[model samples]
Target: NAGVTQTPKFRILKIGQSMTLQCTQDMNHNYMYWYRQDPGMGLKLIYYSVGAGITDKGEVPNGYNVSRSTTEDFPLRLELAAPSQTSVYFCASSYHGGGYNEQFFGPGTRLTVL
Candidate 1:
């Protein structure tokens, strides 16, 4: 209620299946991001938005889709889920000023594709 929240704390998918990772923030942040972290690797940005109805692709946007319809919601869509897509997905939000902004992350969704 105070920060970012992601749904389905855990999930498993078969090859070619699809699912949407839900994210929402109550902090009214203007910037939101979606990232995926593989085991023992750094977090790679998938997509981001500066504000509602505005979004942009990040380092790894393939096999993923996103939309920002409201300031509070930003969901990540996985189409034709693949084994390479199996990783921990995270959602973060932050204000884009003050020199260095801090990101608030959700608990994350652990996804597995088999």
Candidate 2:
């Protein structure tokens, strides 16, 4: 299986612009998440879903949104992007949810908002 895949591996946006970072997994994993890492900082969760029809905001969910309509896709949307939103975005997945959160990650999408 391809595990997880994210498209447009890189992106640059003007402040106030918007974009969607696509994420998909083939592991049939039930848990999906979106996280951002700013330079040397640890990964900050943006949003996550325990399963289809279930979603929750994470630690740093500002300016971001996510949805889990299926077991395979969990895309992230950025609205009115700002320079402060510039970071490396990672999409991850794991088996089950509301428990241990060990996740399998994607190669990541680097987004630069100027």
- What lDDT would each prediction earn against the true structure? 0.95, 0.91
Cα lDDT tens digits for candidate 1, 1-114:
669999989999999999999999999999999999998999999999999999999999999999999999999999999999999999999988334989999999999999
Q: Lowest-scoring 10 consecutive residues by lDDT in candidate 2?
A: 95-104
Structure candidate 1, residue pairs in collision:
none
Best by lDDT: 1
lDDT of 2 by residue, 8-90 (tens): 79999999999999999999998899999998899998999989889999999888888788889998999999999989999
Model 1 TM-score (2 dp): 0.96
Could you say which candidate leads in TM-score?
1
**For model 1, what is the C-alpha lDDT against the true structure?**
0.95
